[model samples]
Target chain A: MFGKVVIYGVGLIGGSFALALKHKHLVREVVGVGRNPHAIARALQLGIIDSMASTPEEAMRDADLVLIAAPVAQTESILAAILPHLEPQTVVTDAGSTKSDVVAAARAALGAHVAQFVPGHPIAGREKNGPEAAIPDLYVGKKAVLTPLPENAEHHVERVAQAWAACGAIIHQLSPQEHDRVFAAVSHLPHLLAYALVDDIAHKPHADLLFQYAASGFRDFTRIAGSSPEMWRDISLANQEALLGELDAYLAQLTTLRGLLAARDGAALNSVYANAQQARQRWIEAIEAAEAPPPPPQETSE
Target chain B: MFGKVVIYGVGLIGGSFALALKHKHLVREVVGVGRNPHAIARALQLGIIDSMASTPEEAMRDADLVLIAAPVAQTESILAAILPHLEPQTVVTDAGSTKSDVVAAARAALGAHVAQFVPGHPIAGREKNGPEAAIPDLYVGKKAVLTPLPENAEHHVERVAQAWAACGAIIHQLSPQEHDRVFAAVSHLPHLLAYALVDDIAHKPHADLLFQYAASGFRDFTRIAGSSPEMWRDISLANQEALLGELDAYLAQLTTLRGLLAARDGAALNSVYANAQQARQRWIEAIEAAEAPPPPPQETSE
Candidate 1:
């Protein structure tokens, strides 16, 4: 699908894309760009990249695609750096968690070449990070969202979609605004809550004892708290408005829950829990149905 | 350990206790008592109980041990029902999630015979419920906390501990007050938060779309919300004061987090996330080390 690809910040998201493309013979070469020479060297040693690009100019030469998979804070700088080197034919995209911020950054940096840029977020995240954590099938069966710009050519959007498809991702598209709002409620809010929970528990006087008693439920509930701090910080800031909106909504929900508990209203409390339980049960069933393999064709009863 | 063992409310917790005891040969006869005749008959059919007791009178006749594994709200009534049939040698214990409430219930119902009542909470909850969900090994390697009262005999507490130990649980003791407070922070608070989150998302106008996008992180974060609503509702009320305290503390934490987001302090945000990440990482390590089989005896290479 691609002859050569340049990926900035070749960590889990970027490296995984590289491997997925290569494994399917979709991309001939993967050139990794990073400020840290040590990390660049390690990615090369790990065989996640075909070569190291010391500069965007070197990375973009003969490259058909450029993917900025760095933290959201770095997207602007990476876009600016690549702008000077981007070829007319190169279709640029990103794997940023937040789309509105990345869209703004690309518009400001790419100028006339903004049409070449396509914004995407592959809704696949793990607590683990860095190059070694990348897997070839990381995007398989995951949602890869694309928020295309008005200036972008139809062919460029198609090119980005095809690349993700090659990685076995299911593609969906939405406007930048809707993407941020939806993710703010579902993804970003959960991450912040998880982080807040862990921070709160960790700071208590008997934190050691509290943690000692935190069993499987706590482990699962707070697993996202173990994600890369710098990356999440960037995301939390970049998507601040939407995220804060979500926080307020969640706070309101909790306040209502508190009231029920304070009043000792067992019926109301049970109703809330039962509603949540039914919704979650439906979700689990949907997931299971999707994951179950199709049954074999039945024979004719001649 | 004794001839007759009567268990009120033969659901997951109660049924599992019966199977665990019978599996280990710690008890000779297990008598099931329930308001629902079908459930009692099912327990007997499952071989979880040696016989079904239609009433507390029948259940408590010559019973050496009585375990109230019903909902916290029902504990008092069950205690009262069994009190009329209590034998001087019988040891009574409960498996409520909250300790202080159970202690109060025992005090009210058992009166002068409260010395026989030992309050315990097995931190072995699953999202599933009912007699069908019972498992013999559910409490194995889990913490079974006993909150012995001042009125209780030491041997009575020991007998309660021995029963849980026979079920493969590691027993710990705490004052009822301390147990409720700690659990309010670690266990109950998480359950409320999980329930609140799911309820919030499930109520949105675009709830279907939102749920479609909800991924693995959301799955783990909301898993506890799938728990039995009736059971959790009772727990929330029983542990009301302590749970409200934890909820308030959590709200304050969220307020601080909101302030950070409003200010967009990237460094501060990163620090909080990093602290939480480190604490959670430490917790995961501790749990793993405990779950891991003990290292093979160190080599004595001469």
Candidate 2:
């Protein structure tokens, strides 16, 4: 709970966070700060925020919380712009996909105030972006990862965690490095591969025919490729080292498969497929078990 | 449209076709032929077929149409077994993923009766298999590709098309070589990549952590990897050459991306993602347009 919450870059993630805070009455007033007047106006009309401020200085003047929800590449500039205006007690946090760069940026920009910054990434979104796409329950039932810096104060981390919990997000903690590596393998790499695969087919001579015959499997596999290109492009570059490591690992696996295919090793191929299939089944089962409601309280007999 | 429709290998595709045919009143009788007595019994009990026959010989004795919906690797043997029992006028077609090998098998097994066979690859299915997973509308609004041989009569091809049309499938005609190449790029190659990606993560040191953080994007992207391993294994080997070519092309694209990433060429990466995003949008629009119903008739000034 806070008196005034300032949300910078009021797009999908920022607007959604503002809406969640407003819905839960966790903040007395939600103030949106962004360069795009049109988006800020839309957020106001959508009731995602109580009001709009043209500058971070105006928005964070008396704010109890400041959420930097801009693109990862812009985190440094946003922090630099807003740090001078923030109150000493204002807890600063971010909703960036990549963490290391943001942590580095906080160190460079916040100086002594780095203790107020808590790095966070909520693993939830859709292909659509913008304030109009924001939903009140976007973070509900989703995992919100917190990668706090060594300089972050315990109170700042606790406040951020409490806010996300109020939004119905299950929280997980990881070191910045571990967080980057895990996300690079599971999220960033899949996005890059999907984009590459779609572009490969698009460049083919028979692209029209190829796409016409592509069924639901192809559609589902490439759905992420339809996400905001600019955002993903920034993420790919910001987390370059970890992403490249993942890409290499994935390529190595593919190479092994290529060799097996060339050698016509059906048994080996079957083994690989079976292993992947069983692993996916296990994951599905785990997720289903977690989601399944507790057996109606056991209905103990009197 | 037929006196007796015999469906060999009464699993997902075969069972669905039988149910669709019966639903459309396209056949006087539906007979199932499968080695699995339990599955055949389930098919009969579910009304996916009117009756059950223990062997291909018994099922094809008076069959007017026969649909072989087994795995691609089994196509040759199934043809060899069924040819001796098929009535002279029987118009046989298959629902295998690969076309060239099935055509080859038909030529080798049918000998003089090869003209009765039509090589087809229905572009439809789900991760689930077996008769229990079958549904009447499985092929509705889906593509069913027909690749007829030079030895085949036009009437046989026409019959297959009509049957699929009755099941609400739109039919496309392509040469066997073209069919295999297109599907290799669109379907087979994607499945292999998904399987390889999943297995790569499963083999990693931090596999549990990686999978725990893996979100909807990874789930959708790898959904096809959960498919029947034996069936996909057979398809991979059956359509080896085209798939290998595709894998090479895909790898070449990835190599280019790796270079751009290493060089930190943000503009180039953004361009690739933007191009893919736009192309995917166009494909989505095309599909939506095709699937959209005709506009309501305008009211004239009466």
Candidate 3:
């Protein structure tokens, strides 16, 4: 699908994309660019990329696509460094979690070539980081949301969409603002809450005892709290407005529940719990149904 | 170890305990008691009990041990119903999540026979309920907390500990207040947060989109929200003071995080996330170490 693809900041998401592209034969050559020479060398050794480059200029020499797969906070600097080296026809895109900041960074760095950039976020990752954590099928069965701006060329958006499709990702299109709002509520807010809860518990006087007695429920709820601190901090700040809105909404709900508890209102508490339980069950059923294979053809009756 | 063991309100915890006792050959006979006749019948059919009784009085006949594994709200009623039938030698205990309330209920109902009761909580369960969800190894390698009162006989507490030990549980002793306070911080608070988060998102204007975009992180964070609403509601009310305190503490922490976010204090945010990530990692390592089998005997060169 492409002659050569260059990926910046070859870590978990970036390296995974390179492997997925190679495994699917979507690109003739995968080139990894990173400041860490050792990580780039490791990516090459791990077969995550066909070659490695210390500079984007060398990597994008003959590239048909450029993917800025770095952290959101680093996207601007990466774009500034790579924009001058990019070919006019090279369709540039990113896999940043926060889209608005990336879009703004593209506009500031790409100049006339802003029409080539597409902002995207693939909703897949693990707690582990680095190139060694990369997998060829990481994007399979996951959603990749694209927020293309009005300045972006239609052909560029189409090319990026096809690239993600080749990686086995389902694509969804939305405005930058909408993407930020939705993700802040569903993804970012929960992560912040989990982190806060764990921190609070750890600082308590009986933290050791509390952790000792914690079971599966506590483990699952706080699993996201173990995520990369730097990555989450960047996300929390980049999407501050939407995330703060979500946190406020969640707090209001919790306060209402506290009021009900103080009033000893069993019926209200039961209703709230029932509502959440039923909603979660429905969500789980939907996910299961989506993942289930199609039914086999029925045998004919003679 | 036991002649006849009677389990009241046979469900996941109760049925699992029965199976564990039977598997260990610790009890000669097991009897099931519940208000739901059909559930009792199902338990019997599933071999969760040797016999099914219509009332605790019939089940407690010739019983050496009785386990009240009902909801906290129902514990009082179960105690009231079974108090008149209990023998002074019968070692009675409960498997309720909250301890103080169950202890109080036993005192109110058992009167002079209160010394026979031991309050306990097995820190193991699944989202599924009823006898169908019961498994013999559910309590294996899990923590079983026993909160015994001063009014209870020492022998009764020792018997309860022995029973749980036979089930492969590591028993931890604590005061009722300490147990409630610790659990409120770790278990109850997380469950409430999950429920509130799910409920809040479900009521939003873009709920469908939010759920669709939610990936593994959100799913794990909200898994506990799918628990039995009636069970959680009863627990919330039963341990009202402790849970309320936890909710308040959590809210205060969140509010402080909000302040940091509003000010865009990247350093403070990073510190919070890093603290949580480190603490969670330590806790996970501790659990793995506890659950891991002892290393094979070191080679001896004589």
Candidate 4:
């Protein structure tokens, strides 16, 4: 529990963190800070935050915790801006989609106090963005991956984990390299594929006709294409190496599929599809099992 | 209105067709036939059909309409089996996902009676299968694309269109070639991409970890992967040429994306994402517009 928390970039992630902490009575006050004053004002009006901080110094004053939930592109700048005012007692973390970039930014900005920062990425969100999209339950039954740096003190990292745990999230730790690699396969690659499909179709002469006839399958497949463009671009660049590796692997998979199609190998094609169907079916079953998100990792390896 | 309807598959599509027809009181009786006698029995027991027919001959008797909603692989066989029993008054149609192959099968098997067969693809479905998955409103507010043969009599095609209309589907016409091409771009390509992504991840050594971290985006993106593998295999081969073309185009699009990533061209990458986001947003808005499925096509091109 914290007496005061500062949430910079009071959009969906920041706003939701504020609400989640308050929902559990885990914090006495939530101070909001953002480059867009109007958004901060809206957060206050929406009861998402108790107060608005016009400056990083003002926001950091007596702040027990600082959650930088801005776009990954602003991670370094925000960290640098708040570093001068950061207190030794304050534990800092971020909800950025990419971990290695955030870790690098924290190291570059926090100097000797870099141990105060714990890199985190919450695997929860909706297609909508901004403060209005924030929900107290966004992280409930969800996983928050923390990639603690070598310099991070154990207690500081634990505080960050506890904060996410208070928000009903199940905390897991992965090294920055592993986090980037795993997410590159599961998250980044799929986002790129969705965006590519939509953008490719949109560039066509018959794009309208294609979109018009697109039914439920198309709707769900391309839903992620509707995500924030700027945010995805930042994540894409930050994790470029891992994502490109994934794209290459996926392209290879497509080539094998093309070979099957070329040969009219229905049996082979069916096998591939059946394998995917089984795996995806199992994944859905696990998701719908109605059991809560897995309890805190049995015996933290870290 | 039909005096009696024969549905040869009794799976999701055929069963839903029966339920929808009965729901609208547009048919006097619905007869089901399938290789799976148990499923056919279930269809009758569930009231999705009024009777079970052991053979095409039995089902064809007194049948005003025969809907061959079986897998695409069985198209020619079903057409061959039913041709002798298909009466002059019985207009035949199919609910296959691919049009060109069904048209070919109709020509090869129906011969002179091919004119009675109208190729159609209902632009709707669920991930579930079997008679239990059928629903009366499955086609409500959905578009059913009918690729009418040039040899078909206008009245026969009209009867087929009327059957779908009774089930709350809006009818539109396209040449078999056009239908396959457009669907390859919109439907088939997306399904393959989804299946490919899931299969690729499933094949990896860290598959469990990747799947564990996969959230809502991956779930929606891969939802189609859980579809019947045998059915998709048939569709892929049936619409092979068109699908391959679309796949090539998508591969090219992915190459462009790879270039953007390699160059770290964040601005261009953002623009591509923004374009897709805008188009998808507008399309979703149009779908959400309070108005119903576009009232039957402006004018029948045929």
Each prediction's fraction of true contacts recovered: 0.81, 0.85, 0.92, 0.88
Give the per-residue lDDT of model 1 (tens digit) for A224-258. Answer: 88899989899999899999999999999999999
Which pairs of residues collide in model 2?
Answer: B1-B26
TM-score of each: 0.96, 0.97, 0.97, 0.95
Over A123-180, each residue of candidate 2 has an lDDT whose tens digit, in order, gives 9988788999898899998999999888888888999999888888999999989999
Estimate, for each residue in B1-302, the C-alpha lDDT of model 3 and write its tens digit: 99999998789999999999999888999998887888888999999998987777797788898898877898878888888888777888889889988888888888877888889999999988998999999999899999988887888899999999988899999999999998998899899999999999999988999998999999999999988999999999999999999999999999999999999999999999999999999999999998899999998898
On TM-score, the candidate that comes out on top is: 2
List the lowest-lDDT window of 10 residues for candidate 2 chain B.
B53-62
User: In order, what DockQ does each candidate have?
Assistant: 0.83, 0.90, 0.92, 0.80
* Model 1 lDDT at residue A28: 88
For model 4, the superposed segments whose C-alpha errors exceed 4 Å read A290-302, B290-302
Could you tell me the lDDT of residue B218 within candidate 2?
A: 91
Lowest summed lDDT across 10 adjacent residues in model 1 chain B is found at B52-61
lDDT of 4 at B259: 95
Of all native A–B interface contacts, model 4 reproduces a fraction of: 0.88
Q: List the lowest-lDDT window of 10 residues for candidate 4 chain A.
A: A288-297
Which ten residues in a row are the worst by lDDT in model 1 chain A? A209-218
For residues A1-302, what per-residue lDDT tens digits would candidate 4 score against the true structure?
89899998888898998999998999999998888888988999998999988788899989999999999989999999988898889999999999888888888888878889999999998999999999999999899999998888999999999999999899999999899999999899999999999999999999888888999999999989989999999999999999999999999999999999999999999999999999999888877774556567688668
lDDT of 4: 0.91
Write candidate 3's Cα lDDT for A1-302 as tens digits: 88889888789999998898888787899888887888889999999888887677797787899888877898888888887788887888999889887888888988877888888999998878889999989899999999998988888899999988888899999999999999999899999999999999999988998998889999999999988899899999999999999999998999999999999999999999999999999999999999999899889997
Error of 1 at B50 (Å): 2.5
In candidate 4, what are the lDDT values of residues B231-280, reduced to their tens digit?
Answer: 99999999999999999999999999999999999999999999999999
